[model samples]
Target: MEFTFLFSQFMSGLTYGLMLFLVASGLSLIFGVMNILNFAHATLWLIGAYICFTFWSLMEAHQFALWVSIPLAALATAATGWVCEVVLIKRIYKRELHEQLLITYAMALIFGDLIKIVWGPTDRLIVRPSIIQKPLFLFGAPIDSYFIFVILIGVAVAVGLWWFLKYTKYGHIVKAAVYSREMVGALGIPIPKIYTWVFTLGIFIAGLAGGVQSAIGSVTLGMDMNIIIQAFCVVVIGGFGSLMGTLVGSLIVGEVFSFAILYWPDGAMVLIFVITAMILIVKPWGLFGTPLRA
Candidate 1:
């Protein structure tokens, strides 16, 4: 491949990686705090896309509409997540992982059906904002403005979350919980409330990811399945629930998929799995993950 081709491929990889990071970060946060696999996470993302599209369609078409719709999408998904937690998930906090997974898996079906019932099975695309439809030159290659925004947004979120987790009182409590859940509960920290906050925060991030997704393409029913598999791969490779690991793992998986598609399209899907398996064999806890002691 020519140098220019390789450079373009790298850029593509970076963009895709950033997208994966946003989605995976939410998954990691939820798992890290709650020890539950949220089957409805990806569905929530797709819901955000539809919500954003609908909101934008209702408003006067302009930059203002774009700005308004994006936050609405995020907030709407967050609300759904909050409801899901309060109504069903809260009761399962002490259940085994497999049982939790079963409940959530059922929710995934319920969510998909709800989407179909509400939005129908038809494919719907969002209109990209004028601000994001243009392509800007990056290293002499034309990069889509929407992809650039995705990358910037991912970076901003990573930084903001890092600061929040590292500097806040909640962060300290979370840190304690991570090490010893029983002890933290004993210490008089409202464990249930903390879990609620953490889970809601995770859902909010997932919703934000979905909102960003809307700008790139139409919201479709299949997106939930598509993104969930990728997000799982990211979490596994990054070490079940590690934030920094999610970031690094996302970049690796994204770039690998991008470059593989450019060089050998057939192997693209299997490549991430292959690499993840190798990483787990060598370092089961992942690059940034810490194995818990019995």
Candidate 2:
């Protein structure tokens, strides 16, 4: 019984960790490549969830509601991201960090308000589609099939990203731009275009996170702020702009939250900060983070 209980917790933690990784990876990628700390990221996620819910509700009679809603919601969020990058973010690249933060933070507020206007004050949820609604028995335990699907999606995303970065030409350009934007530009590459792409990619991933999250819980007003804190912590502790670090940090935060909630319900949220502080005390730059420019 003890072993089975532990296994259940482990699976739960792993499922949640994949979602965290999905969200954190985008933030890390944006920060590493474009040096933008996008405060609007979680807002994009919230919008995604709301959009997914809306779409699913509209198409509830459809047999493939989940499949239809997810991509549509993600595309909507990506369009929002594209507009932000092309219009607002493009103009602010040379601004101070505080200025960038303030603008993005304000955008987050705007998105929150927009969501309220559209979805109202009610908490929304997207039910797991009937296709994956049944529980799968594993190790004498019934596990949610949707959770398993989410985990598999996360793994696929990770592997896809790795392959894209390693084998694709644009990926190579992005990497070069990361290390030396000036050099890449000097070599006739359009660095601004790259930044736009990076921003789009970042928020697109955030949107996907939101779409996935719709299956797990309520899409409430403050959901943006809720995940943003942990996303920031994950990136900071795992090393800013490090994809693998985001994965590691997500696992740490997710598992810590899972176990801590089991052991000390009140401290579940607090323990993540405790772990972040400990990691920073030892390696101030984060486990895999490169030194930042002063």
Best lDDT among the predictions, by candidate number: 2
Residue 159's C-alpha lDDT in candidate 2?
85
Q: After superposition, how far is residue 130 of candidate 2 from its true place, in Å?
A: 1.8
User: TM-score of each candidate?
Assistant: 0.95, 0.97
Q: Residue 283: error of model 1 in Å? A: 0.8
Candidate 1 ranges with C-alpha deviation above 4 Å: 292-294
- Compared with the true structure, what per-residue lDDT tens digits does model 1 show for residues 121-141? 888776765766777777777
In candidate 2 the C-alpha lDDT for residue 113 amounts to 91
lDDT of 2 by residue, 1-294 (tens): 387787778788888888888888988888888888888898899899988998899988787997888888888899999999999999998999999989898998898899989989988877776878788878977777888888988898888777877899998898787788889999998889999998898888888888888988778899778688988888878999677788888988888888888999998888899889999999887888888854
lDDT of 2 at 110: 94
lDDT of each: 0.84, 0.86
